[model samples]
Structures are given as structure tokens and as C-alpha cells.
Target: MAWKVLIVDDEPGIREVLKDYIEMNFEHTKIETAENADTALKKVTEDQYHIILLDIVMPGLDAFEFLRRVKDLNSLIQVIMITGNSTMERVLESIEAGADDYLLKPFSTKEIEEILKCSFARIERWRNAFRNSF
Candidate 1:
């Protein structure tokens, strides 16, 4: 099965770029986009996703707040914070709030692809461990 990704960004261009890039390069993955945190939250609640590419700053309920809420809703969901503002504080906060990884804005498509690959590998390892425990 293809891994699913949810992308939350206020900018339509960014969302489109990510969606197109992922679709073009990654045959084993699919991506969905939401323009805001609220909509993203609703979608996440309705469907399971392998990874979430979330922007740090939005019109309302910024990525940090969304990350916290997502963790509260589903601990297994892996969130990868994406931001133009790459501050140490934001990175640390994202980690504290349970983001699995953080990517800076204007990052190369190759970087994003690498991160997704690592995320999938990590999830596979986790699944294996969980199955073994049963």
C-alpha cells in the first residue's frame, strides 16, 4: 500500500508544489492538502496518514498548536514541521510537541523525498516491533 501524507499550508502554491513533486517522484506515496489547521485537523481525524507536512505559521492555530492537538488525538501520527522560519526555538518546540521531524522552507525536493523515505522506514520498524509484541 502507498504511504499517505497530509500537507497543511496556507499558501496554495506551496501545497500544490509539494503535492506535484511528491506525486511525480514517489510512486509509493500519496498526498492530500489542507489550507488551514482546522481543516487539516478534521481530515486527520477522518483518515489515517503516514506523515503530515505542516507549516509552522498559519492564519489561526499555528503549527505548534496543531501539532499539540494532533498528538493528543493520535500519538502514532508522524508530523513533520515545515516552516520558512527556521529558529532553534521553533525546532525545539516542535520536537517537544511531538513532531517526528522538521524541515525548513525552500528545501530541495530531494530533501523532502529523503525525509519521507526515512519516515516510512521508521514506521515500518515500529510496525514490526508492534507485531512482534503481540
Candidate 2:
């Protein structure tokens, strides 16, 4: 299946690295980038994304807030929070705010691949369930 993914982060380098790695390793995946929460929100409304890689330190609207908004917009969309800080409180907060998963900053390509694999599996299951319901 072709997957649509959005990478939202304030740092251009993080966005580029993620985009590059995913593009290089994953086939038939469409990836987009947003530099801030506002732009990310606009894109989320405009497009259908199976997975979103969102940063927790965005400049405006806050990352947790953004995650909640994204969940409101599409409960089926899986959001994986990206953070430089790995505090337990923040991780718990993200999960409580409706994030599907999270990745620490400076993550390896292997980690990204693993998380994406899990997200894709869950997405597939959701799609199948929706189809069966119809």
C-alpha cells in the first residue's frame, strides 16, 4: 500500500533527514513536511495522511495541543510525537493527549523504520475494519 505521511518540525534539518531516510528506505510512501504547527494543521485538513511525525517543540499552538487537534480532525490518523526531551512526564502527557507513539530526537533510521512498520500495520488493520463495517 502507498502510505501518505507528514513530518512536522521546526528544524529544517530534522525534517530533511526524516524525509530523506523514509524516502530512501520505504517504497511507495508519499511524504510532506511542515515547519510549524499552524502549517501542519492546514496540511492535515487539506490532505489524508495515514501517519504524522509531529514535533513537540513547535513554536506556535504547542505540540500537545496540536496532537489533540489532529486527533479531533481525524481519529484514524496515527500521530507519533517527536521530542528532544525524553522525560517520563512528557511521554505520559503525549499518550494522554492521544499520540499513538513517540520518537526521541537524534533517532536512528532503524528506529524510524520500526515505528513506521508498526504504524503501518495498525493503519492496515483500521482500514480493513472500516471496510468490513461497510
State which candidate has the highest TM-score. Answer: 2
Give lDDT per model, in order. Answer: 0.90, 0.94
Candidate 2 error regions (>4 Å): none
TM-score of 1: 0.95
- Residue 92 of model 2 has an lDDT of 98
lDDT of 2 by residue, 14-35 (tens): 9999999999998999999999
Per-residue lDDT over 1-134 for candidate 1, one digit per residue giving the tens place of the 0 to 100 score: 78899999999999999999999988878889999998999998899998899998998777788899898987777899999988898889989989999889889988998998898888899889999999
**lDDT for position 43 in model 1:** 94
**Where does model 1 exceed 4 Å of error?**
none
Instruction: Provide TM-scores for the models.
Output: 0.95, 0.97
* Clash count list over all predictions: 0, 0
Pairs of residues clashing in candidate 1: none
Against the hidden true structure, what lDDT does model 1 obtain? 0.90
Model 1: lDDT of residue 16: 97
